[model samples]
Structures are given as structure tokens and as C-alpha cells.
Target: MTRDDLIAMLREQTPACGPARNALIAGADFVVWDGLVPANRHAGVFRTRMRRSLKRGRTVDGLANSVDILRRAGEEPLRTGSIDAVDRSFWFMIFLNSTATAVVACFGGRRPITMESAGL
Candidate 1:
């Protein structure tokens, strides 16, 4: 789909607060960054740094659980047709954002919320 199509779909389907929306926003940011900088110069480094950042001050199990949520939530948009085919960098950012958002939403609260409970 075109950029405008993607944006409209995102606005329509993404919740006010949740993993899907977080991933969409992150994907958008990645698109912008990819346009400005060569992916070879930044993508790997960014991914590694983000992983380490998420691991800091968090348990491995918590991190793993967050990752699982991210994987599920990130694919939902694509599977539902909110997004069309995208490049590897776009997918990476979606996963990164979803994972990061999940970690925050899950661990930041007294109790972890499921993807359904998160309102998608």
C-alpha cells in the first residue's frame, strides 16, 4: 500500500494506547530515518543498543514475555491488512517498538496486561 493508505489504516485501527499503535509509530520513524540515513550505517547498531537498553533493570523472563507479546502484536497489523508489504528495516522497527512498548506497559504496571486486555 501507499504511505497515505498505511497512515489512514493506522489511524483507524490502532488503539490509543497499546503495542500495535506503538509499533506503527515506530515503523513510521524508521521510514523517516531510513530515508535520511543509509540503513547499513545505523540499523544493526540501533537494534543492538535497543535490546541492551530493554534488558537493563528488567528480568530475563519479563523481557522474554514482552518479546512474545511484541511478536504477536506486530504481526496482527500485517495479518489484518493494516499494513502491506514492507522492507526488513520497517519490520525491524515495528518489532523493536512493539517489544519496547510491551516491556514498558508490562513491567511498569503492578500487573502485566495481555494483548487482548491492552485493547489491541
Candidate 2:
């Protein structure tokens, strides 16, 4: 969808949804899922990091769980990555899945949220 399309959806949908995890739907965008990490400069970083970590025998958190929660709460996964941007909390984007046709959510909170969006 176009930027206008995203903004229109945000305007109409966000207010109705209200706050989630202390988040207000700041905005929305039509974007590709990138998985780059340590500086997410690529779209495939989501899958890549997940795969790499798993290969190293790391126990990944239930990322799918987080996605499910976000979707149920009316959000879509955009760029998945661990960012220090949330005051010790990790952040990820949910760009309003097509079903909702609504606003995107940047889901984050103390403790590791989930790795589903973080994984490839």
C-alpha cells in the first residue's frame, strides 16, 4: 500500500484500538520485512538472525507468541530487530497486517518479548 493508504488506515484505526503495552499507534507504513541486525540495514535480517542463533544452539524465545499477540491486538510485523530504543526494552514493527487494514504497532516491553518476528 502507498504511504497515504497507510496513514489513512492509521487515522481511522488507531484511536479505536487505544493503548497496548503502553504504546499508541504512532503511525503506519507499507514495508518489506528485513532481517538485518546489529544495525538492521537489510530486510531479511529477521530470518537470518533467527537462523544463525538457532544454528548455534541458542534457545530462542517464542517469537510466534509475540506475533500472535500483536496480530490479535491489531498490528503487523514490519522490521524485526532488537533495539535499545525503548529504555531497556526491545522494539519491533507490525505494519498493520492486511486483515486489519489498520494501524501498525511497535510492540515492546521489559524482558525479551519474542523472537518469532526476530527470526527469519
Candidate 3:
């Protein structure tokens, strides 16, 4: 898929809360990472590094370090012209918290629908 397509998929999958709550969802150029690394190929290594760093909490420095580790893997699975295990895993790491939000935005409105209002 194209970059725009990837962004669209992410936007659709990301829930309207946490970091994406009020921010415009757009693809930032992660020159050091993004398609430069095959996340799936080095999932174990990356996960280990990420887990270690995140143990200090989700600070900017920690996330940056994690991204750096992924970057070193270089493009392969990500550059294959289709979404693969690497892409999915990397996306999951980046968007995990936002996925926690189950609240969908109100139809044609900015307000987020409450579970009570939705009668769920």
C-alpha cells in the first residue's frame, strides 16, 4: 500500500482518545525508522529493547530509543510494497495506547459517544 493508504488505515484503526484525541492524525516522516526497518524480522530483539526502555515509563526518551532500535533493522519487510508482519508489529507498538479507547466519535459531531448514551 501507498503511504497515504497506510496513514488512512492507521487513522481508521486508531481510537479517538489518548494521543490522537485532539491531534490531527497524520504520518510523520520517521526517516530513522518507518520503512527503513523490518520490524517482524527483529521482533524479538526490538521487543526486548522496547520492554527494557518502557520499564522506565513511556517517556519521550524511551520511545525514541525504541524507535532507534527498530531503525537499525533496515528496510526489507516494510519495503515489500504490502503490509506485512513487520508493519503490523511496528504499528502496534506505536499505537497501542490509543487502541485502548473504544469510544467512537458521535455521528457528524465532535463529541465522543458515551457508553451510556449508546446503551451499551
Candidate 4:
């Protein structure tokens, strides 16, 4: 899919809430980790990274969960390589938490595309 397509997909899947309750990744050069490498996930999305270490934020984990959903849906799998982490050993991932279920997507590099999805 194209960058815009991916963004749309994420946005559609994200949930909307208050300021910090929104499902969006804030940064520049946002990309999704499909595996060991950083592949171009979607364009027009935020893409930011940590120069010193990765931050443990809700958005980061959310993005990773989205990736996992894609994989489980028979789509291509995404993963965080050594570069998308603070230690270059463990893979960074995102997840979605709800009252009933939780899912682990994949790790992403840089910033994530700000998306507000409500499973639309």
C-alpha cells in the first residue's frame, strides 16, 4: 500500500479520545518495522527517534500492537530491529489495550503517524 493508504488504515483503526487519549504518534519520518530492518511504512506520518534511548510511551506500544494485528490478519509482519531500540538488543513494540482485549503489533522506528482510530 502507499504511504497515504497506510496512514488512512492506521487512522481508521486508531481510537479517538482526549488530548493524551488520542491514538497518534507524534514525530517525523514515521515508519513501521516489518522485521529486522526499517521499511518505509507510511508517508505523511510523524517520524521521530531518540538519539540516546527509546522512550516508553503509550503511543510507541500502540504502534507495535497495530503491526501485530496486521500480521495476524495474514498481512506482512512488522518488527523492531536492533536500531529501533534503546539497547539495540530487544525489539520495541506497540500494543492496544481495551477493556476486553489486548494486541501486540510491531516495533517502529522514528516517530509514528498521528492517527485517531476507533476501529472504523
Error of 1 at 55 (Å): 3.5
User: Across residues 1-120, which tens digit of lDDT does each residue of candidate 2 receive?
Assistant: 444543344332332222222232333222534442222222233346556756876633433333334445432233332222233343334334444354443332333546764463
Residue 3 displacement (Å), model 1: 7.5
Alpha-carbon deviation at 97 in model 1, angstroms: 18
TM-scores for all candidates: the values are: 0.24, 0.28, 0.29, 0.24
Candidate 3 vs candidate 4: the lDDT winner is 3
Error of 3 at 108 (Å): 28
**Which candidate number would show the highest TM-score if scored against the true structure?**
3
- How many times do residue backbones clash in model 1? 0
RMSD of each: 14.1, 11.2, 15.0, 14.5
**Candidate 4 stretches greater than 4 Å from native:** 16-27, 36-120
Model 1 segments more than 4 A misplaced: 1-4, 8-35, 57-120
Q: Write the per-residue lDDT of candidate 3 for residues 15-107, one digit (tens) a residue.
A: 322232222233332211234335344445545655774685543222343344334534424321112122122222332212322211100
TM-score for candidate 2, please give it: 0.28
Count clashing residue pairs per candidate: 0, 15, 4, 23
lDDT of 1 by residue, 1-120 (tens): 344433333322212223334445445322321122222233344345448856665322233443444444432321111211222221212222221221121211122345874779
Candidate 2 root-mean-square deviation in Å: 11.2
Worst 10 residues of 1 by lDDT: 101-110
